[model samples]
Target: MGLRMASGKLRQSFRIYEWLDSHKISVTSIAESIAITPSMVSHTIRGRKNNRRVLKKLVDLGCPQEFLSLPIDLEKQVAA
Candidate 1:
């Protein structure tokens, strides 16, 4: 068995995603920067792709790779 996330449920707990959303950064913006479509971002966010490529995107967005290891406190971040 593999790690399982709720299907089609956005893992919004990531601090970056949360912060962006908090600042009202549209999903299309994120998608544009990441070279993916808004719907693709929507799908990936919704946990439709449990692989969760957000980490890579974070790196592309200039977030330090070391921060990848930081505890995300998924529950709180997602609930925000």
Candidate 2:
């Protein structure tokens, strides 16, 4: 619905980290699944990371496509 980044970088405001925290999903687990380093995941959770590959992998693992879009509204995210 907006001019979203083509790279699909994950943004902190989207609260994907909160969901992961609630589910007890560790950064290491995500890193392993995505073939990336844990530091990358940690940086992302801390809002200092942005990688298209990482975002793509996260999406494939069930992160909503909305998270990759601009002006995300957490209230509108579909339930997991």
Candidate 3:
């Protein structure tokens, strides 16, 4: 899983953003859920919500981790 993890940082960040963005979810709400500031998450993904805790929450919200962990354009998956 090293290869996957090695690529996880960017993938995870992007996946997190795409997931939340698509849902029309606000950064403040996401931040509240992850216990982090909206800026921290925003900074991570270029103004998109991107944090490990957020990803875990998204996963818990029914997003399959297998697909989430993959380094793909997550926008398509999470859009409406």
Candidate 4:
């Protein structure tokens, strides 16, 4: 089976996308820098995929670490 998009956009993913846009960073550029396909980079940004190399490169390029990991639901955690 193929990977499918998440039903809802992840919080971290949205933040990362916004940060990339604000910084004028393009998925194509990141992909080229890492020798990966643009689709893979896009997928990673959208939370449909995970790639350590891509994540590392984003951080190296000044992306905030908070936007690179899954978001924790503090409310849910407190309730649990």
Candidate 5:
């Protein structure tokens, strides 16, 4: 294992995906901007990817700070 997140589960809903969608920015476009794959971006939104580098990139791309305060609720979101 390279780096394991302290919390195996992500602990917040990073709204980056929503922002990108609302702004009509394609995942590929943002991925290119951040030098990460589109799927990595998708996984971040879904709370499946929790690498520090990716999290930092999301923040740089305008992910709100408030999202960091929201508790992780992947199962709840999935159920809804």
Candidate 6:
């Protein structure tokens, strides 16, 4: 079974992902800016991982605070 995520958080995650996409932000760039691995940033973006530092950096880069928080189930979203 896939991990479960709240509908609200799922939507928020998507919003954050979309915002990043529209702004041409890449996981590699985020990782470089925050001194973390690109995989960590990518996982965080996909809601498969949670890293406070990464989330903070994303907020610093203009992502809305409300749309960023905790981790969700990317697999479930994809399956749907």
Which candidate number maximizes lDDT?
Answer: 4
* Candidate 4, position 59, lDDT: 71
| Candidate 5 segments whose C-alpha is farther than 4 A from its true place | 1-15, 68-80
Candidate 2 Cα deviation (angstroms), residue 5: 7.1
lDDT of each: 0.52, 0.58, 0.55, 0.71, 0.56, 0.69
Write candidate 2's Cα lDDT for 1-80 as tens digits. 64334322445434777667777877788889888898887665554655545655666667655554422332233223
Better of 1 and 2 by TM-score: 2
> lDDT tens digits, residues 3-62, model 3?
333335444556655767788877687678878887874654442333556555566566
Tens-place lDDT digits, model 4, residues 14-49? 788899999999999999999999999988787777
Score every model by TM-score: 0.44, 0.55, 0.46, 0.69, 0.55, 0.65
**Tens-digit lDDT track for model 1 on 1-80?**
43333533434436546655666766788778767778776655545553335545654565443334322443234336
In model 4, what is the error at residue 49, expressed in angstroms?
1.4
TM-score, candidate number 6: 0.65
After superposing candidate 2 on the true structure, give the runs of residues whose Cα lies further than 4 Å from its correct spot. 1-10, 69-80
Instruction: Give me the runs in candidate 6 sitting further than 4 Å from their true place.
Output: 1-11, 70-80
Point out where model 1 deviates above 4 Å: 1-19, 51-53, 58-80
Q: For each candidate, how many residue pairs have backbone atoms clashing (under 3 Å)? A: 4, 0, 0, 0, 0, 0
* lDDT minimum window of 10 residues, candidate 4: 70-79
Sort by lDDT, top down from the best: 4, 6, 2, 5, 3, 1
What TM-score would candidate 1 get against the native? Answer: 0.44
Per-residue alpha-carbon lDDT of candidate 5 for residues 8-76, written as tens digits (9 for 90 to 100): 254454455566677786768767877889888666666676644555555566666445322334323
